[model samples]
Target: MSKKIVIIPGDGIGQEITDSAVAVLKKVSDKYNLNLEFESHPAGGTAYDLCGTPLPQTTLEAAQNADAVLFGAVGGPKWDNVEPTLRPEKAVLGLRKGLGLYANLRPIKVADALVEYSPLKEEIVKGTDVLIVRELIGGIYFGDKCESEIYEGNERAWDLENYSVPEVNRIVEFAMQAAKKRKNKVTSVDKSNVLATSRLWRRT
Candidate 1:
């Protein structure tokens, strides 16, 4: 069966990189004789300019019905002043939330061919492959009370950082599975020395 892929050519470098990535995917599809169909759509700043909304209903409906979504980065200085809820970044966040893509897998490959890219010595970074599995939809980034408010003569803002056990467990499982496939090691990073939430994360 042909796989349906929805491509969102977001903003900025997104247009350049996504085009290259799609081209590579197409080559692989042809070589492997894999049935694939790609549908391109717009979101973020460009979409906002055209439709007055960063994420359009039509785009959302198509993504919801597609087998998978290939998303590029979103956000640019032009849309920087836009309201936080309507900003370009919000569109990317909205899609992640809408699709329930709660785990982010970041592969850090230190290849000899690109060792010059890093400041570290070739000996230190060479052949160093790491996968940074991050919890995408929880903790401080998606917390409530994340707004500024004026109190008395001074201005104070507070953001609540809360997480349930299930959330932690799910992320841990994802990390563990990824680690098991590679180095069989997992290193969790957080400010456990200070934040209570971090302490809970450490305990969990």
Candidate 2:
């Protein structure tokens, strides 16, 4: 059976890169004799300009129905001053939240051909590869009761950082497994010496 892949050619350079990715996928499909179908959808600032909403219902429905979604980057200087709730960033966040994509995997790799891309010395950057398995949905980015307040000539603001045991455990298990697959070492970074949440994270 053909696999359905939903593509969102979002904003700015998205069109350029998305086309390249699609072409590569198509070539691979033809070469391997794999059944693959692609459905392109609009999202982000472009969608907002066309449909008056950053995340259109049609796009959301398509993504929900598709087997997998290939996304392009969103947002640009044109939509920089837009309202926070209606901004292009909101569209990406909404998709992640709606789809329940909790973990964020960022692979930092230094390519031999692109050695000059690194700010570090050639010797230090050579063959330096690392995987950052971040808990995307449960950190300060998604915390509740976050707001600023000012009253009586005094200003105060607080951003809550809360997490459940299950959330932490799941992320840790994933990170450990990822580390085991590579170096068999996991270096956990946190402000455990100061923050209460970090303490809890360490304890858990």
Candidate 3:
């Protein structure tokens, strides 16, 4: 059976990067006989220009059904003045919501050969391996907000930050399981002193 990979090349350098990545995937598929199929979908400012929405329904459906999605960058100053809902950055948020994606795992590892390329000192950059697990599709990003409102006769804009125990527990459990596979350590950060949500998160 062939596996379909959805490619979402968003604005800016997205096209160039995804094109090169697809070329590499093609070579690897041919060499290993992995039977991979590639499909391109528009998103971000490009999509908004062509379809009046940062994330088209077709693109979201394709991504949801694909075996995997190779997503490129999104957002640029070109679409900064657009409506909040149709902003280029909203494409990524839409995909996360439509695909039920909640975790963003970022791995930072310095290879022996690339140590010189790092801005950090050689001693600090060398032999460094770290995994930063971030929770997406929650918090202020998905919370309620007022783009503009009147409070005490003053124009105000605010975004609510919210978190539930279950939501916190799910991500924490995932991080714990990930730690078990690595160094058996997890470091969680939050501003519990000031924010009620963070206090709940810490307690959870």
Candidate 4:
């Protein structure tokens, strides 16, 4: 069966980057004989501009039906004044919530050829290769955010951050699995000193 992928080339530089990504995807698919179908859709600020909604029903349906999604960047000053619910960033949250995607993986590898251009000392940056795993859906991004609350006679805004043990475990487990395939080292970073969620994250 051919795999269907929904590509949302969000806004600004996103369109340019996703275009290059599409070319790479098509090239790799051809070289590996991987049957694939890619469908492009507007999302984020672009979607809101065109359809008055960051995540339109048709885009949702296409994403839901696809085997995977290739998401470009989201959010820019252009949509800063938009309603909170319809913000460009909400498109990412919507997709993550709709698709039940929890963990996020980011890998960084410094090529030997580029090691000399290291911003840090060459010794400290040598052989710098790492994978950073993040738990997406259950973090501060999904928590309650508010504004116009009075605190001690001053107007204030607030945000909440939270994490469940299960959420932490899943991402950490993914990191562990990734470590097995790499150098068998996992460096988890958390600010247990300042956040309750970070404590739980560390324990997990």
Candidate 5:
């Protein structure tokens, strides 16, 4: 069976980037006979313009059912005045929640050729390879918040910092396993001194 890849070219330079990515994927598929298929879906500001929502129901469904998803960037000055909930960036948050994406793995490695281009000193970043595992779908992004409210005659807004035991445990366990594959060292950043949620995260 062929694997279907859903391409969500959000806005701005997303179209050009995904187009080039598809060309590369096609070449790889042909060389390996991977039987890959592609489908395009609108999202971000583009989707908001076409369907009145950054993440349309149809696009979400298609993403959930696809074998893989290739997402380009989102957001630009064009949608700066849009509502916070309906902003182009919300499409990424919606997709993360809808797809149950819980972790963002960012691998940082400095290649020999790119070491000279790095802003950091050559000796400091020459052979650096680090993986940053970030938790998603359960932080302030999904927390309850008020855009604007008057409190004590002062205009203010608040975003709740929320987390669950299961959510913390899941990401911790994933990071632990990932560490075992590398240097068996995991550094989790938390501010238990000032935040109650960080305490729970550290405990779990």
Candidate 6:
């Protein structure tokens, strides 16, 4: 069966990196005679500048129709002053919600051959392999965005942070399941010292 992928290159180096990655994918697809289609769409800060909305309907539709969507970076110092609702970073949250996709998993492994290149002591960097699983597209990233000029003659901006029980449980279950495939070990990290969200993470 043919595979469809939507590629969204948000801003900055995202375009360059995604372009090179897609080129390689095309090459490998040709070698294996795999039918693959890649469609690119604008997102993030650049999209807002072009169309006045971070997540355009056309872009979202393209992604929904594709088998997978590749994303590029968005948001930067240049867009720092944009309206909270229309901020470039909102594109990610919009896509995540619209696509019905959640959670992010990142794997880190220290190559045995590249051990000597480590900045840390050999002992610390030696067995540095871990899996990081995160709840995608929630919390502060999707919370209320605000910037205000208070009566004190100072500007303040803040994003809300929150986590639901279902969200926490789901992500934790996914992480533990992933761990079952490896060493049957998991080291969950959290800032339970302060934030209630972190505390929720701990409770789950």
Ranking by lDDT: 5, 3, 4, 6, 2, 1
Candidate 4 ranges beyond 4 A from true positions: 23-33
Q: List the residue pairs that clash in candidate 4.
A: none
Distance from true location, Cα of 155 in model 5, Å: 0.6
The candidate scoring highest on lDDT is 5
| Better candidate by TM-score, 3 or 4 | 3
User: Which is the leading candidate under TM-score?
Assistant: 5
True-structure RMSD for candidate 3: 2.0
lDDT of 5 by residue, 169-194 (tens): 99999999999999999998999999
Displacement of the residue 70 alpha carbon in candidate 2, Å: 1.1
- The reply for model 5, stretches above 4 Å from the true place, is 112-126
lDDT of candidate 2 at residue 70, scale 0 to 100: 92
lDDT of 6 at 18: 92
Ranking by TM-score: 5, 3, 4, 1, 2, 6
Per-residue accuracy of model 6 over 63-143 as CA lDDT, tens digit each:
999988888789889999998788988898899889867778788999878989989888889888898887886788777
- The CA root-mean-square deviation of candidate 5, after full C-alpha superposition on the true structure, stands at 1.7
Candidate 3 TM-score, C-alpha based: 0.91
Local distance difference test scores for all models: 0.86, 0.87, 0.94, 0.88, 0.95, 0.87
RMSD to the hidden true structure, all candidates: 2.4, 2.5, 2.0, 2.2, 1.7, 2.5
* Clashing pairs for predicted structure model 6, backbone only: none
- Candidate 6 ranges with C-alpha deviation above 4 Å: 76-80, 149-156
Residue lDDT tens for model 2, 1-204: 899999999998987899899999999999998888999998899998998888998998899889999999899999998876678877887788778787899999888999988788899999988999888777676676434588678887666788888888988999998988899988888899998888888988
Better of 2 and 5 by lDDT: 5
Relative to the unseen true structure, what is the C-alpha lDDT of residue 3 in candidate 1, on a scale of 0 to 100?
A: 91
Every model's TM-score = 0.86, 0.85, 0.91, 0.87, 0.94, 0.84
